[model samples]
Target: MASTSAPARHVPGFSAPAVGFEEPFAMLEACHERVQRTLALLDRLREHVRQQGADESARQAARDVLRYFDVAAPLHHEDEELHVFPLLLAQAAPEMRTLVQRLQQDHVDMVADWAAARVPLQALAQGEIEGFSESAEALFDRFAARYASHIHHEERQAYPAALHLLEPALLGRMGQEMAHRRGAPER
Candidate 1:
């Protein structure tokens, strides 16, 4: 089978930019960029599987997608939930409260979506399946689309509003907590 790995390299934002937790909002934005890259990889993996079957490249792509959505994505969402959303809920207007609530729900929905999406990906990664079923393909599409929309909402609306509300001290605390959770050493 022809290697499909070459295209994976061209997926934008595949290598995340260096953004330390010292700038929490920038870190979160960088996570969004990573999310976009991973989603692109997921789309490409799906296409590759359809055309080329479960080769090593496809297996590696499946593993890559699983690792991101399983580990980093959850941590990123937790950072927003624990640090960003609570602040917005307490201090911002009712509209912001609603927005945070919606975002929180998006996090929940995404977890569920990932649960469903992970099954086929796990199978693909293990080389048990040659390609996604039609239903799995649809699930993948919805998963990627939902993330794209969710990231847009957070970036264009939620992050800016929350950033305006946070003081320097809170930002420092937020950064520290974020780094500590990831087990990074104190700087």
Candidate 2:
């Protein structure tokens, strides 16, 4: 018998993710979309756990959430730290500097919390039913609160600063770099 690799599947009308100097808005939008996706999954996982129906598929879904948390979420945060936040700091007044600094502190705090959070998520993924649901729900609440606050901070503070400080040309460049760094398709 001959073995053959299957052809790649494509969703109809789907293009590669947008990528280029034109994509900062889209890049930010994609991160927010991922946040929404994880939040929905978290809600479903909690529901499954409540009903005591968190079987193998539930466990696998739990694992998928963790994978995105580990990979995409942290990278997004790092991108802000390296690119977005520093640019704000460089141009903000002394009074405004403290808020940017606080945002930076939030990033550190978030990363630390992430390290602790993995324990509960792993427990969920492994189907450790004893306290997994309660622990996970609590962790998820904290994570959600932190994220809600963080994104709000960006919206109210950092994003405004970026828009104010960066020229149209620089913003365009930043957008391009962000899209490429995120591996959204090459354009």
Give the top-scoring candidate (lDDT).
Answer: 1
lDDT of 2 by residue, 15-102 (tens): 2245323756446655756666776777787777667776887787778777767766776776677667788789888766787888
Runs in model 2 deviating more than 4 A are 1-21, 128-136, 184-186
Q: TM per model?
A: 0.90, 0.78
Give the per-residue lDDT digits (tens) of candidate 1, residues 103-178: 9999999999999999999999998988899999889888988898899999999999999999999999999997
For TM-score, the strongest prediction is 1
